[model samples]
Target: MASTILVTGGTGTLGRHVVPLLRGAGCSVRVLSRRERPDEDGVVYVTGDLRENAGVAAAVAGCATVLHLAGGPKGDDEATAHLARAAAEAQVKHLVYISVIGADRVPLAWLRSKLAAERAVADSGVPWTTLRAAQFHDLTLAMVEKMAKLPVVPSPGGLRLQPVDAREVAERLVELTLGAPAGLVPDLAGPRVYDLAELSRGYLRARGKRRPLMPVRIPGKAGRAYRAGANLTLEGATLGERTWEDFLSERVA
Candidate 1:
């Protein structure tokens, strides 16, 4: 029988690519989602929310491995714990997690939630591998769109990030799923880092929009964290192939 892998959040950005890769590797894939969808060839789609223990348990049944990627800005701790418990109950062999780089160092609420999820996975007693990566290129584009809508793009001076391609991250994740559960693997970063203001300007230039860049000093712990470079990978870890400029041009064109 082919090894079965359960992919949580299989309908998401990274999942879309990871699922296909796993199928290509001859692994039968079962995707957990919130909505029911028709299963594709060599893939099964199971509708369930991570918050529901019974649903998660059902999704993990008979699966040898799990790709736990369902996470958000809220209830991440509880959600991760629920999934961890489910994986344990189902006796899943390996649990692969996708986490953010510098999650431990960043003071943002979202990062804290991600760190809490990581802790839950560690304590789940299941063999796990966590891949911490920089912000996705899609995430950068979303940020730019949000900022473009605002009257002024608020750029916290000195904030830098190494935004990586989501597809590349997904490919690395697929490779990790086949390996042993190595805890807290090296950080995955992009080709280079750029200041927030400079990136914003790059976006504006790409889109042919002339908007005033407002470099402001945000007054909060989060702002301080950004200014302190909390979002960057300091160890110079695995660099992805895609550059931000290349991503920007492709996205803009």
Candidate 2:
């Protein structure tokens, strides 16, 4: 494969970590973003919005590999389809994607979008690989921080999370991007799992704050899925080294 690689969402949490590592690997990195950014530190910035199918073909042109990570609360399915189609037209060699762990099992709109995005890439005629990873420490921190802001935090009963370090996920993604496409490899999760209560308490303790956590049930199929641990990968998965507590100590402390 050529050394030039295009990374979508190269400004987000995981992308921030992945770009530097790719640069260190002696690969020329091209980042596509909605807004224009000046090129710096040997990285090229291309202005494009994947959601609107704008500048996508130009972004994928002449790049051997495309590391797709751009996502949002919605429209990921459509955006990924746009990217995949463009990549196929450009005759790109490989397309690597990052998806959430419960994408296939969770009864949520966002997860459904992710699953559709996976399908778009798989059927795009470009060789592809997909990694289903747990929530990142950064995202978990954001969640708990918001919860701690409330006078009484509503802890959803049976809702658990296995938060992994974004850097570790980044490293693994870089390894996959450089190598051959392996369709749907094992899930990647944190070293340990923590329930919603435990996660909230950890955040509260880290920030030297206290809040009463009221147990609230998530209604319907989504609730049942959470209670059944459908979001978890207990077996046949790759586990990260960092724990939720490890993240709290460094970030919150």
Candidate 3:
């Protein structure tokens, strides 16, 4: 593999964590972003938008591997396809993607896009790997904060979430990009699973806010899938290095 690695969304949460680790590992990292950035010590900041072919081509060209972390509910499919095509053209050895834990089973809009992106990477003919990780503690806390905006906090009934630390996921991605491509790795999840009410209450306690939780059953197939634990992996899967409470303690401290 070449020494230079291209990282999409290098300024994102996971990217911010992964880029430094990759730099410390002695890899010359290139980051693609819509906005221009000054070059770092070992990171080559290449401004390129993934929506267009030429931009993606510039980012992937001359890079040995790609760690794609830029995507959302909208335009994820298109961007993934474009980035994959560019990587294939550049003969990139590996393309490691960070996907949600239940992309294949969860019916969420963003997860659907991730599942499509997984296909794009696999079908691109470039050796690729995908890691399905649980939601980040930060993200879960953000969700709880949004829920708190409502008059009453309505927790999804029987929804158990395994919120993984973003830093742990970033470390795993860096390790994966350094190794040979291995299709799909076992999911990375938090040490413990917390039900919706419990998680919400934890957040409330941390923030010194008390809100009575109203457990409501989320109706439909997606809710059923969540209630059935489609988002959780089998036994012996959770990485268990960090916990949401730990993350909260750090953030609050």
Best candidate, TM-score-wise?
2
Better of 2 and 3 by lDDT: 2
Residue 99 C-alpha lDDT in model 1: 91
Find the number of clashing residue pairs for candidate 2.
Answer: 0
Candidate 3 wrong stretches, greater than 4 Å: 236-238
Regions more than 4 Å wrong, model 1: none
Task: Quote the lDDT for 16 in model 1.
Answer: 84
Candidate 3, residues 68-98, lDDT tens digits: the string is 9987658788899999998998899999998
Which run of 10 residues does model 1 get worst, by summed lDDT? 47-56
Task: Compose the digit string of candidate 2's lDDT tens values, residues 37-89.
Answer: 99998899999999999999999999999999999999999999999999999
Candidate with the greatest lDDT versus the true structure: 2
Worst 10 residues of 2 by lDDT: 1-10
Q: Could you give the candidate ranking by TM-score, starting with the highest?
A: 2, 1, 3
Candidate 1 residue 187 C-alpha distance from true site, Å: 0.6
Which segments of candidate 2 are over 4 A away from where they belong? none
